[model samples]
Each structure stands twice: as C-alpha cells, then as structure tokens.
Target: MDRYCRRAGALALAVTAATATGALAQDYVIGVAVANSGGLAPFSQPAYDGFKFCVDEMNASGGIAGKHPIRLEVRDTRSEISEAVKFAQEFVDIGVNFIVAPPDGDPTMAMGQITSPAQIPTMTFAGTAPILTSVGEYVFGSYPADNQQAAVLGAYAAELGYKTAFLLKSPDAAYTQFGPAYFGTVFEANGGQVVGEASFTMNQPDFSAIVTTIQALNPPPDVIMTSAWEPDFPAFIKALRGAGVTIPVMGADVLDTPTVRGLGEVVEGVVHTSGGYPDPGSAHAEFNARFEAATGKVADTNYVVNGCDILGMIDAAVQAAGTTDAAAVGQALAALPETEGIMSSYTFAGTDRMPMRSVVLARIEGGEKVIIRREMADPATMPAP
Candidate 1:
C-alpha cells in the first residue's frame, strides 16, 4: 500500500481492503465495476447482468483453465467518474486478478489508469473513444471507437442510396461532435451530400423548436441522423414524427435505450448501429438462453452480450497465456487468434486495446429491434485521426 501510494500523484492510493469471503488461495478474482443507477443506468445495468451471468456460468463449468474457480467483487460506480476511481483503487487493494471496467468511455479510461498502475488487466465493453487505443497494454475494449461507428453509419447511408442527409447533434458532447465530423467524411466520400444541419442544447427538454427547424429544411433530405442519448432520445424522435418529418432516421449506438426500443411500431425506418444485434443461430444463443432462465429477462441489448463476451475474452487471454499474471495475460491477449464470442469474433492488435470485429447495423421495424447485418467499418471511410 505504501509503495503504491508513493507512486500515486492525483491517482487513487491503494489502501488495505478485505476481499470477498471465499478462503481458497487459488480463487481467480474478477472485479466488476459498474453503475447500477443514475444517468448511465440504461447502458450499465444490463451490462452488469451480462458480466455476472458469464462469471456464474464459468464457475458452474469448473472455472477458467479447468481448475481455479472464479470469484467476483462488484462495486457500483453509480455512473460517476469519482466513484469509478474509488473502485479501481479498492479493487487493486483487495488483490483482484482482473477488472471488468465501467461501461462508459470517460470513466472506463480513468479506471484503466488506476488498474494499469496496479498491474491489473482491465477490459471494457462501452469505451468508444478513439484515444482509447493508446491507453497502454493493460486495458482493452470490445467495441470499435466512435470514429469507427461513424464510418460504418456513413457507408451504410451510401449503400442505402441516400443521396442527401441532415445531421442533428448537441455541440456540448464530444461524441456528438465526432458523429457529424466523421460520419460526414464517409458520407460525402461515398457521393452523399449534407443539405442542412441543426444543433440542440444538451439536456433541453423541449425539442419542438428543433424539430420545427428540421421540418422546414429546404428540399428535405432522404435521411436524418441524430446524435443524442436516452431521455433526449425519445423526446427528439417523438417530436420529429409529431412534426411530420418522417425521413428515415439514423443514429449511433447512444440510441440503444428503452425510449427508442419502447417506441416499437410507432418508430419506423429508424436504423441504429451497435456492437451486436439480436440474430438467430448466433454464437450467443446458448448464453442468451441461460441468461433468460437465470434472470427472467432476454438479453435485449448488445451491452448484455458485450458483457458476457468480456469475460469470454479474459478467459481466452488466460488460456492463451496459461497464467493469471497481468502482464503475461495482456501480452497473450494482444496476440490471440480470432475467437468467436457471443457478440462478435475478437482479435486483438498488438499495438492497441481496440478489438477487431464487424460493426452491427440494426433496424426498428414493426415495433421490434432486429439485426439487419454484420458489416465492417471500412478502413477506406475511417475519419482522419
């Protein structure tokens, strides 16, 4: 503890903390860091269940490497970066073997700093910042970064023959800015044009004014793209439809919330690009079945599948390395062959933490979320770094 504290500056200081109640010396410890409530709940909660479900299944199957049983230590971050920081220090002090990081980019990146300093392997499902690739060797993410998501959406629009589009985003959010800048690059490169655009203030309740502006665009576009989150998500869409602006709506992964899915039939022609989409005969089917039985709920979102796959990835890394040593595990993880998981096939590049997988495009039709296709975020359309 004193050694880690000396190494710490603004980073969390390791303090003596008791671990979980299991007495076995060989128990593999995994720290699940999540936000069970607050603004991030919609994304984090299902993800928590996914990680929990996978751990339980692994334990039941006799644990990793067919010997050491897994143990879990969960800390609720409540969607706050401060809380996430505390969890990272506490998990290290308690001697966790690895960490399942928070489901958002900002906190997950911050969490990685603490875990990396402590020599713990940390992987996340929702950290999408392109900068995440440079978070050192100890941290990893299963999804492509925001720029990747933008590239996929842009190319998809061109494939759908949408010649013109209108993009709506909040200037206040960094990811929103990435949406227009990156998506616009690929869209125009593919012969599409942006006719007009609108911006909304973050957290503004009434989008009626914004919707009016969209409705009045001269020569309305073939598609309308929005960069918004949950509470704002439904409000904007409902207002758009109410104002009779029915051009096909496109959005990034932020729209993968109940507000949009809850709209069902009322929400038509809305396409969302996500990490994974529900599909028949998917590698995740067996796990999804067990998940429903255990929790009485289907794995409704990719975060759920992503969470389960997070553990699968660690398991692969452990097997490839043949040891739980954090540094060795990271080295093996970076060199792992393409392995199929519930959400996608993960293959790590030696230079960065981002995994290579197909970007999933989903559509809302007849009031249900359906997987449309597994597509690549082509390198050709990637936004300039």
Candidate 2:
C-alpha cells in the first residue's frame, strides 16, 4: 500500500481498537484524587462525599444508560501538590477515563499538568484559578475563578460603604494570593482604601503578630478582608476579636469551607463570598434533601453542591459522547450550553473552559450561615492573569 493509504488504515485500526476497548468494559472507572488528609481535607472530604452521592444516585437510577456501571477510584492527595502530581501519573497509568482533582488551585494546576497532556478529562474542586483551564482542553472547573468571586465581594463592600479594609492574605496558595489581589484592586477602584495588608502562610498557627499589625493602625480599618481557610481561618478571626478589633470581617470563597461554618456564633456577622450555595434554586434544594436522606447528614458546605453538580455534568457529557473517550467528553462538555445543576447553571464558555455561573454572598448570622445574595459572576471584571 502507498504511504497515505497505509497511514489512513493504521488510524482506522487504532480507532476501532479504542472503541472496542471502551465498549467491552464492564465498568467505566473515574479516578478521584482529593485532599482527604491535610489542611484542605475538611473541605475536600465533603466534595468527595458529594461526588460519591451523585455517582451512587446515578447508579441507583439504573446505572448510566442501564448497562455500563461507572465506578470511582479514589486517592487522597493530602492537599499537597507533589502528591497530586504523583497520583495524576498513576491515574494515567491505570487508564482511567476521567480524573476528579482537588479544587485548590495549586494541586489542581499540578494535576492538569499531568492529566491534560495525557489526554485525560479533569474537573477540579476549588476552581480557584482561571489558569487551571489554560493547562489544556481536557481540564475543567465549575467555580468562577478567584478574581470573579473577588470582584463580586469588592462591589458588595462598596455597596456596604466600606471605607477602609485590612487585608490578610494566605501567601502560599494561588487560592489566597490571586483572590486578595483582585479584591484589593476592585475595592480600591470602588473608592475604598486598603488601610494595611498582612501576609501569612496557612500552616502558621499563630495570628498574634498579624492581629497586632492590623491593630497598629491609628483608626483601624472599618472592614477586614481575607482569603484564609480551615485552622487558619478560625485562628485569624479569634486573634482579631481577641485584639479587640471589632471591625466587620469580610472574606473570600475560602470562608465557605465547612470548617469555617463550624465556627458558628464566633464568626457571626462575618461576610463571605462563595462560588455556590447550599440551596441556590429548587434543583439545588432537592439535591440537598436527597443527599441528606441518602447519607444521613446535612449539606453544610458549598463544595458538596459543586461536587454533585460537576459529577452530574460529567455524566451528561459521557452520555452525549457515547463513549468514555477523554477527547470526545471534553468536546461535548465545552459545547454543552447553560446546563442547570444543583449549584448553578454551567456553560464551559467555548475554549475558555471557564463557567460564568452565579456567585453567592453569605453571612454568619445568629450562629448559622444565611444567604445574603446571589449574582451571576461577570467574568469581564476579572483581572488579567
């Protein structure tokens, strides 16, 4: 045969082999790498549980087109970038069709580096950075990037007449770093002044020094804006209140974490920005009820909602593509229009691969998280990366 004819025949043979392999599979395995242990574990756990709940529900509803059972193979990334990268390699080696990675920007970026080039479709938990999608066409995130969420918060602060803010930044992670920067820019643009800015790594147990820095200001800030999570989040709040800093506290999406909600009354009156809410609409409310009934637990965090929605989206894309091929699934997801889920409507937004779903603003009031407002995130306001 001539060279062109040989090449075409080879390509056809490869496609036939791939199709047969996918069709013959008794189970389609989805690989999950989450921060099951580490600083991010508390938040990641709920996301993983929510993903599990979605997959289980789909299974109960007759198992993915009534034939091929979808199963998840989970691995704990321990909230470490190295672990996430390492496990991404393993997922590729094991030939899983899709990978669900931790949402935190750093780990998600690392997973994208590994999975994207390997032609694996991936979705992340945190969706903290817009650059996550820049990794490749296969990487997807449901949450608006940090800048979009921050823009909403900045506008809200302006609305609330916040004149000055003390900024507390988690300097080590992308989630914390980029969020506060966009927030600062938008806040300042809105005629609010950032009185002072302090930075800390998440692992630092003590917030006394940072508290002192904020308190040193002559008049002090009228509001404090921060992007901190877990142990750091509560500690920062405790220290600020302890130092007699009574200014209203405002924070980014990190505050929506389950651990932060557990702070209860102490975090009362604290304003937080979030990518999704527990019950954003009727569908989300139904999801929360079904999740509770299935697991015997309350859906306390937004991650739970996002997790279910992401998995559901993947299921939809797979059905549309008619095969577990990674490239086909990615294309289907990108082309899918404003599909509604428990969290919010998601559209892959062409090659951008970023969703412009709604953002939730909530405050801790009377020892419970009360939804203050919900607005569709405008990506146009986001700063260039």
Candidate 3:
C-alpha cells in the first residue's frame, strides 16, 4: 500500500507540471468582433486588415513585454447589434481581455452593455459621442465624433459664404440625424442660415422627391449639405444632377469614401470632412502601405486607421499595465494620457473615452480627395461659430 501511494503521488506531480508548462506556452487571445461580412464589410475589412498588420508587427517585435505572442480571435458580427453583443459575451467567455468592434453606432453602442457589465475593455472604431456619454465606462472610441465633424463643416461653410444652406439627412439613423442637427446649430450660430431642411429614410432607392422639395424652396439655398449613409447620398446626388440642381454639395465623413468617388462626375466638386486624410504621409504611412499591399487597394476613409489605432492603443495599454488581465488593461486604457497613432493623436478627456480635440477636414477635388486642413481646434477653444 505504501509503494502504491508513492507511485500515485509521483504521477500526479508530473501531470501538474505538464499542465503548468502548457498554460505558460499559451498565447494571449484578443477578440475582434466586426461587421466584416455585411454592408459595412467594405469598411470593416480594411480595419481588420489593419489590426492584423499591427498585431503581426507587434508579434514580430517579440510581442507585448516579450512574454507572450498576442493572437486575435476574429468574429464577424454581420453588422447586427445582437450579434455584436453575443460576440462580446463570447469573447469574454473565451477569456479575451481586449476587443475591437466595427463602425456602426448601434452595434458599438450594444457592445457597451455587454462589456461594461462584464468589465471587459472594448474599443470601437465608430465615433458616436452619445454612446460614450450614455455608457460612460468600458467603451472607448478612436474616431472623431460626428458632431465634431458637423461643427467643423458648418464653420467652414460659414467661412465660405454659404449663408443660406440646405440640410438633407436620414431621419432613421441616429448617426445621420445627429450630424445635421449639430451642423444646423453651428451653421446658424456662425451667421449661416439653414434655409431648407429635409429628411429621408435609409436604403431608399430614390431621392428625387427630396431634391425637388429643396429646389422648390422660395429662394434656393446656396449650399446643399448631406448627412445620410447608404442609398441616400448617391441617390440624392444622382437625382440632383438629373434635375439640374448644380449648387455645390457638402457633407460629413460619410462622403469621404470611394463610393462617393465612384459616382464619377455626379459627386464632383462635393466637399467633405474626415478625421484623417487617406494620404500615404499621414501618420500611418506604413500601415497604409501594408494595407494596400495586402488588400490590393488603397485605403478609404472609414475606420481602418481607427482600427489600427485601437490595436496600437491596446498594445500601448498592455505595455503600460504590464499585464494581460482585463481589469489592468481597462485601467491602462482609461488612464492613457496621449498616444500618437495612425488615425490621430488620441487623448482621453472630459469623462469621455476619446479625445475631445483633434479633428481634420478634407474635400474631394478633381475626382480625388484631399485634406483641406488638419488639427482643427476643439470647439470649446474656437471662436463662437
């Protein structure tokens, strides 16, 4: 009996040692839940590519603190809010400390409910300020807010002498509604008049009625400002051109896409604003190069840079926290003062999980987009516009 007991103890000790070795050999798994297979895939794919590139580069450099190689466990949310929430929970269940989500306001907003309760840190490529304001902790956004873009575009329109401007937007989408609301407020405050305003539904195949309504206003507005996603802008532009409404068209960040450019001459001379320019020299040149080389296409102005920044930010926080624990990473992310990234220099401020300042404006000219200006001052510091 004594000999048998000694042999059993030895076997148990060897098993325990093997288990410890296996645990030590395991790599840290990071979750990436994105809308990479839906309507937003065009935007999310580049973001995924960017995150993969950043992670690959980091792993090549011996990974975070040289302790473990980080592995990204990607899940497609299909642009659905429920799917996003489920993926967040799934990631948590799988013991992933970090997550990066897509560019939709609703899905990202839904992630807040999941990650906050579970105490998992989530960074969204979407820039819906209200999401951060409503959720408070457990969520950080890397993109500039739509309201900020609206304010800047409004101020620019005011400067450009577009006193009587027409506002067109999609009433159904929160992102679409918020932009024009903020733009109208700033435009009116800056001595510009929103002479006409109209709202349409998302995925609507035609905007001819909206265009006709705007044109029939007593005195036509000087500039037409668009704040819709999906079929609205393309339809509106095509309808407006068909109706011979040639006034300059302006819009928010949604206009800074290849889709707009693909409209060819219909969208020519349209002005838009973006958080970061898509040029090679803009902060993340290497990222852009790698993205183009890998995807066989130039990067567009979605959240790809923001996604890269999200990964880089996580890496930075991991470096700062010195651990892969979710709580430690959350603290590090919330406490991050500033970090230079591909999108923009991010700094947390005003209880929001993103930088309060740091935005840029871009315009499409000669069938190509160009950065009109960068590093625009925060709204609080700027002259009352």
Top TM-score prediction, candidate number:
2
Where model 1 places Cα greater than 4 Å from the true spot, the runs are 1-25, 171-173, 264-266
lDDT of 2 by residue, 302-327 (tens): 78888888777887788878877877
Candidate 3 ranges beyond 4 A from true positions:
1-26, 278-282, 381-385
Candidate 1 lDDT, 75-103, residue by residue in tens? 88888889998999999899888888776
Ranking by TM-score: 2, 3, 1
Candidate ranking (lDDT, best to worst): 2, 1, 3
| TM-score of each candidate structure, all chains considered together | 0.87, 0.88, 0.88
lDDT of each: 0.78, 0.80, 0.74
> What number of clashing residue pairs does each candidate have, in the order they appear?
2, 2, 0
Question: Could you tell me how far off, in angstroms, the CA of residue 348 lies in candidate 1 after the best superposition?
Answer: 1.0
Q: Which stretches of candidate 2 lie over 4 Å from their true place?
A: 1-26, 65-67, 262-265, 278-281
**TM-score, cand. 1:** 0.87
Q: Candidate 1 deviates by what RMSD?
A: 8.5
